[model samples]
Target: MQITRAQRSAVAERITQLERSFYGRGPSNVKVSVSQDVPVSLVVLSIDSLTAADSVLSARGHREAVIRHHEALHDVTRADFINAVEDVVGSQVHAYLAQVHPDTGHAVRVFIFADSGDSRELDSLDDRDD
Candidate 1:
């Protein structure tokens, strides 16, 4: 099983949309992809410029503090993130894994969907002509 290009784009667009509404403004770039593993649909979203402000603070020797703050911020908004992903994927979100790499000035959002419509079955209903 593989997550098609259509699925990839759909997830990416949703993430981009969330940036403005959730984070004040969209990131510089958002890359999204899906891994076709068994039993679940795993989506990985790489967000650039997500940690920019924190990175600047990190350079001032408060890296740990900034990192902790980032973690707490995400925790506070985790529910909204999960809901957004679920809406785009049209499946129940089983798990949401979020991480920020301040060293790299990037963040990752992974959404694992509880098996909803199987890939084979979703091919027909997903908004893809293929």
Candidate 2:
């Protein structure tokens, strides 16, 4: 089923609320988009202005620290995020990927939904060398 704009907005709002409740702060902006692919559907959440500490740490030449902090926090709160997304999308998320940019203090969270049809097979690396 195709995701609707209202559903996307609802997902984004839920994510924002989760961030605020879990992290004590929410991003300055949040965007949610859906992409339908061959084997699965992807719901992507992009966030801007992660945190004030990100800028401070990056300015002190501890950019990696900022990234690591976000990653660790995300890991700890993974289940909460996954649950919120699943609730809004009304589908089980098979995989979740998250990343943060040290310089820009931007982050992206991708929720991969299960496929409802046969998946396309990919060629092996050896086949590509032929």
Candidate 3:
């Protein structure tokens, strides 16, 4: 099934709401888009003005720390997010990806619903020996 613009907007609103509910405030703005290819559907959100001073510090000299921190924040909210999204799109989210650019005060989140065989759960996994 294809995701409609209204549904995408609703998803974006829910994300903003959840951010507020979980973190006490939402970003300055959020934009959401949805796309699909074969076994998985992708929901992407572009967030603005989301860089916390602490997160930026973590980003500057400790890239891994920042990524983990970003993941942890998303992990805490994943249940509500995945449930709401699955309900909206009528699919299960097999994996989720979240990223932040603290220097730019921007963030991106990618929700993958279903296991598309070609995809990588983590880019590092590509280097593992078969």
Query: What overall lDDT, based on C-alpha atoms, would model 2 receive against the true structure?
Result: 0.74
Q: What order do you get sorting by lDDT, best first?
A: 2, 3, 1
lDDT of 1 by residue, 1-130 (tens): 4555776677677677666676666667777767667556555555554545676787887778776876886777776777666666667766677777766657788777666543432333335545
Q: Is candidate 1 or candidate 3 better by lDDT?
A: 3
Name the weakest run of 10 consecutive residues (lDDT summed) in model 1. 117-126
Model 2 lDDT per residue over 1-130, tens place:
5777888888888888888887778888888877866435555555565677778899889989988998898877877887887787787676678888988767788877766542211223226559
Query: Candidate 3, TM-score vs. the true structure?
Result: 0.70
* Candidate 3 positional error at 96, Å: 1.3
- TM-score-superior candidate, 2 or 3: 2
Model with the higher lDDT, candidate 2 or 3: 2
Per-model TM against the reference: 0.72, 0.81, 0.70
**Rank order by TM-score, top first?**
2, 1, 3
